[model samples]
Target: MVSENETIRRHEQDAFDSTHSQEERNEHGQFATPYDLARAMAEDLQSRVPSDSHVLEPSCGTGSFISALSALSDSFTITGVEKDSSLSETAQRLWANDSCNIVNADFFDYASSESEQFDAIISNPPYSRHHHLSQSEKRFYSQLAVSFSGVSLSGLAGLHAYFLLVGTGMLKTGGIGSWLIPSELFSVNYGEPIRKFLTQKVTLERIHFFDPENLQFDDALVTSCVTVIKREKPGDGARAVFTYGDFRSPRKTISIPLRELAALPKWQHLENYEERENHSGRVLGDYFKAKRGIATGGNSFFIKTRDEWHNEGIADEWLSPILPAPRSFHLSEVTSDASGWPQESDIALLNIPRTASYANLPTPVRKYLDGCPEKIRGSYILRHRSPWYSIGNTKSAPIVCTYMSRSDSTPFRFIRNKSDATITNAYLGLYPQTSMSEEELDSMCNMLNNIPSDVLINGGREYGGGLKKLEPRELMSLPLTSSPS
Candidate 1:
């Protein structure tokens, strides 16, 4: 049995989804907050706000927070601001009987124009990727951040950080704010500005990270966290509490002095970290030189399975054994057969020559090249090469690591490559440094295979839909906590 409110909310959501394409939602960085999460945040917020306090919800999509606010016994006035007009109207209709006002306007512009101080401001701000904003908008926000928070945010920081900074300006001194944001802020370089502001300009309170394995939003694949902050500067020797798991009752919590947090480059490292006396450590880059695999502009046209290659009569000389995509095999160690092909997988890349004599080539090979479409030939990767089909150089490396994965449990898989096979850009190849001898290859691979899951999560960046990605630089920067004998 569905309640009237739930049915109405579903219809409104359907209308919103139908009117806006996925691309539009992505561009605007709009995703409705889950009701359970909203209610939980509102419950936590109750203790912070004074009686009859005026509250503001920035970028409120259909007023999840407004609905949550109504559940409380406190008599408070709330203002919900949303950029999307239709969503604002829907929220307005839903909260008609409550002391809620919905404004359909850009939050940044509204925040700038307002002189009213809010007792509290809560939001699940848009996570707009920096690239999505035009140069002028980014520049404007970057400047405004410095003026408001005394921290000049990098252009690479997401729009959510800007919202946090701007919302702080609207809060009355000693007021609190709670934000639902991605966990990347603990690890990514771009989050430095927000970190600095929290340390210097405002009172850092608490952070609750949702268990990475259990995603908070079904539509979003990001590891989410709720951050609680106060507008007032911290007292001397102040500490911030960081918790992992459900906000209602976290799995673990750690208290760190604000001064120590300001010194750390990666906040995720704060978990279970103890300072070792006189212990020195090196990063993965000191042991290995990591490089991303070759990228063929078009995988569909150039990559072929074993049966497809055999059926097409592709010549052996023009084919190179290529490892299958990450999902195809589940082995930590890959071995090769007599033909130097990966025994666990059967895939080949159509490797063409830079200079070829068409008349002298086998009839089958020539026919295949003739069938190559203009689009494939003109692809960005191939167009620069002398022959469009000629692929970049590739060689087998002793170890490989997956660049991307959807599973938080195994976001990065290390592989011991006992095969003379090249990989696509989907993987990263790691070669031993000068100090690491070939004798240590087996030990190195074993160590990589056993790296703790938490270490991998802290070292990599997460995308929407809980996808984890690690660039060659980030992989190289991983701190090696264990050594091979």
Candidate 2:
């Protein structure tokens, strides 16, 4: 008879070949965790799991966690279940030295049937969104959440959340789990349920947020975090650790009392160390409407210098005094003319059309546009229908934020809007309405401008050439000075 290990290995290879064509893996965000990260997460869990514990690694991609567990402790019994047969097989081969119970099965399906509870559950679950799942599958996952957390999680919650919810359920009381997931859950609105579950149902022991500048996954661009939690809530006054910076080399560690964590509405704000001061009345949100910058489908095609506009025979009306990407706009305060145009500026602007418009431009411009490949045009600033120009008027806002920035030398930077030429979508335009007093708007602007660059970069997603993009929702989540209505 074939050995159990060899059987598992064969199944894993066969399943991998059958289930995932290379393209499918890429589409599904199925990049396996690097050994280093997996090892670190496993070690982090081992520090919490008691000796002789039963550990479960749900959604074990190729058994990185299993390998880490085996290396960390031979005494701890391990059970690894992988959705992909080929990966499960590979994991079986990798852990043949140890007698791990390896199963090739879908975690979402198998987890519900598990009769035994584990002392620790660990995984780097797939990040695929619910849309990828069938309606029946989504309902199954949603029902699973109800079974696990008592509270229902939206199907919109990413697969990772399901793993956490289901994995937590499979854990014995006092069981601990460590997960490698996108740091976005801490701040995103959709993650509110997960956070609530963590704080109330289980003990959220610690979260180690990685620096956004040094992306952890080669295949994925998102900044990630390792969340360690226990199945049971700790007693009163218990504190949970919140570590930030490089996980490999942490720079800061904070121990926040569970009560305090539970009190806070949003966990992302915790990273900023927000302190609530005694207040008498209203908040900034009460007085002024906070709005992020407009998003031009494409920036390079729209934002251009006057000289470039004139030289290219593009109308001045088609161009605007848009802020350069974060790196180019260095100054905080900008002086503008009586009409709000920049008094003196070094940057130049040029007109380019949206994807469809490119083919219809004049010969010279068309030739220039044609020289650029479709791949380049499809990116954020290039995909618009009329790429050569944008629509925002020159009525400048009192405050502006760099839509994209970096952390090379300067810590955080914001440029004041002083020109009549309004910025394109690459900026957060803060326009104060007539209802709000100038002082109140200025105060709010000052508060926004003061946000640290590191925080800004971390909150936003990065693009080509280290460029970062912040959606309106992401920017709105930043801790701003608020007064009651």
Candidate 3:
């Protein structure tokens, strides 16, 4: 009977989903949690808290967690906060007779007035990226993060991290929190704070990573996880539980000491890592030093085809040949033309060396520099540089790599660069370090391509649609066939 009602609620959620476009929801970070997944999380939390515990959902959209808890037991005192008026009203109306209170307010605002107030907090918080926030908002979230866990969260963190950590303060010392969030939180650089919060600030009971290929949310492209954390600090010799596959019937499980878990660079690295790490002491870092391609203050305004650059009356000295994004290239290997431009495209970066004098520049070049948009000129990357127009590090790469790939195709590709032309931020420049021979490099590239991308990229970042990102450092750590010294 409860299952039947949940189905109805899900249908109602779909009805509301039509009112707003996916882009709107993405900006608001308002993906609704599935009823079954919410129920599974609630069942875990339900076992930890007292029957009469007052539970809070910090970023509840349409009461998925409330419905889950209600189905489990009527004894749970349920309160959910939703910022969207339409969804908040719908949640309030649906659970009016079920003893659930749906508060239409921002979770951050609600959190400010409350602390140590709930026995359990079950939520699928907003996954809005950091860019959605204003500077003042970022400052507030960062400062609060430090206050909560003594862990300085990166400003690059998505909105979900703030909600996850802020809720920790609202819980009683032993309260349980079960959040349904994207798996990105376990591997991204910004996720370091979350790992620390779990192992240092609280006890992580279990974190179950759903198979990326079988995503839990049909509407979202991201792989999801059930992060179950207890409010109390980790105890001595505490072992955090790690699980994979379906929550009810996980395919694999591992328990690592909380102390040891905290030491790992990424929590997601626990997936088939040991079995895949079979290698001589050397990795790609031994043969090549991976450097990310240059970043322009604004790609569109600063980068243009040679024809486009010439038309603008800018001198060739102000332009440097650059490889376009990986999507633009059809072949794995990039070759150079007689003029040193990439054969694929005539794209060139606006190269103004730091040592170049702005006063002695040509009129056309000065006019071009002056024409830089205010937004681009004031960009974080540009403003930090000594000369706002200066963009160095444009050098030929011996070998390059495409960072991400679809699950159906190869996970990563190592492209041999046959060009003197450099690359943009689209690729990683793998410059030879150990005087690796050409045949050895070819063999190494073949070996990397042959290894299962999942095995090769284990412990790295993943995205929706089974897309995986190989960080510059991750590229260096990749196992290599080159003989170790």
Candidate 4:
């Protein structure tokens, strides 16, 4: 009973999905674009280019963009470069028209050898995380940025950021380029190079950020934005349009000066309804220092519950009270026993002091450690330390906030740690600055806990799955609504 279009769509998805595992697709950051979005991008590109212009899709997947472009115009010769041979071949078969050309090649490699520039380069580049890349790959790309544009990119820059540079390199003089990229580039440290290139190198035309609550890709967790740039010199007083909501028809728009864009640390604020007036009032950073919670190289092996430690006959002296996972800790305040252990949480972190002699250790503790996995000893964090098991010195903070949250989930929990407890990377520890009192901190915690949802939305960056996360610096930069007296 399925319609022809429905049957065709189902077949296309089955063919694409059968070629690679989800892990492989994630490694390559390949998420198929929806037809509507691809069409929107094609229409935008078509509006700018001449009828006979040469257009390129650098990371075309299954030819969604190609089909859209073809539907828009038969005048332009559309060329697509896709890394996956199966998808490239599929695209060629589906769009068998002579106007379309699908090249099965790696975009980065192809871009390097390509001497001719295209009139328009439109793509949704791979969103692979930098951590997924090897050290050699990182070094090569880091150096590539410097050699290509004289801009030194952060080592943590993602695959999509590098694609922007490549797209820039492939752009003809005054040619247009548009990319559908994760919205994280607005504020993440790694996005600085791309932001610099956009402001200093290209004439940034418009940035359309889709609504965070209404995700574009059902399978992907990332919120996305469309970035439009032209390889033309920016003029004095030039400004870029910042649009929010749907990519095609935005709910709201703001015009930001190019100079302002260059100076601002976070572009998320541009989506705000109206800029807050300048104020010199003390911020969270003024009264407290925020640092991410401990990153134990191997959490499963290093972090254990009290039950597990007791079963192994480990002594309390060698362990530190650690907060339970953020989702498990519901209350805003944590009370402790006389031993300084969180009364409500049973989780404890395994700690080994550097000065302590393992030779003098209790037999039970030594035996337990001997049974530990060899992988833990070779872990990145442990391998670098003198003693493999030592977690280093971490003092309990007066307040802690979970670094990430789901939009519909409870607001980011700020816990008053009234115990000698440490937390994992899931939380950020907040220590009072010099001269700040515990009572003042208590008030600040309460105020921060009551932060308006709108404020949080504007301050934090949304990841895939509508998960909102804040870095220590971003959380600290947030302007306090009221001073804690």
Candidate lDDT (C-alpha), each: 0.80, 0.67, 0.80, 0.81
Candidate 1 residues 292-404, lDDT tens each?
Answer: 88888888888898678768887668788888888886788888899898998888888766566667777777788788888887777777765666675868887899978
Q: Per-residue lDDT tens digits of candidate 3, residues 326-391?
A: 887757666777877668678788898889999988888899989988999889998998888888
Q: Report the alpha-carbon TM-score of model 4 versus the true structure.
A: 0.88
Candidate 3 lDDT score relative to the true structure: 0.80
Which parts of model 3 have CA positions greater than 4 angstroms off?
2-8, 97-99, 274-278, 295-325, 328-393, 434-452, 481-485
lDDT by residue (96-140, candidate 4, tens digit) is 567777888988778767788889988888889888888887777
lDDT of 1: 0.80
Ranking by TM-score: 4, 1, 3, 2
Report backbone clashes per prediction: 3, 28, 1, 3
Worst 10 contiguous positions by lDDT, candidate 2: 279-288
Off by over 4 Å in 4: 1-10, 94-99, 131-150, 273-281, 297-315, 337-339, 373-384, 408-410
**Every model's TM-score:** 0.84, 0.73, 0.80, 0.88
Q: What lDDT does candidate 4 reach at residue 480?
A: 84
TM-score computed on alpha carbons, candidate 2: 0.73
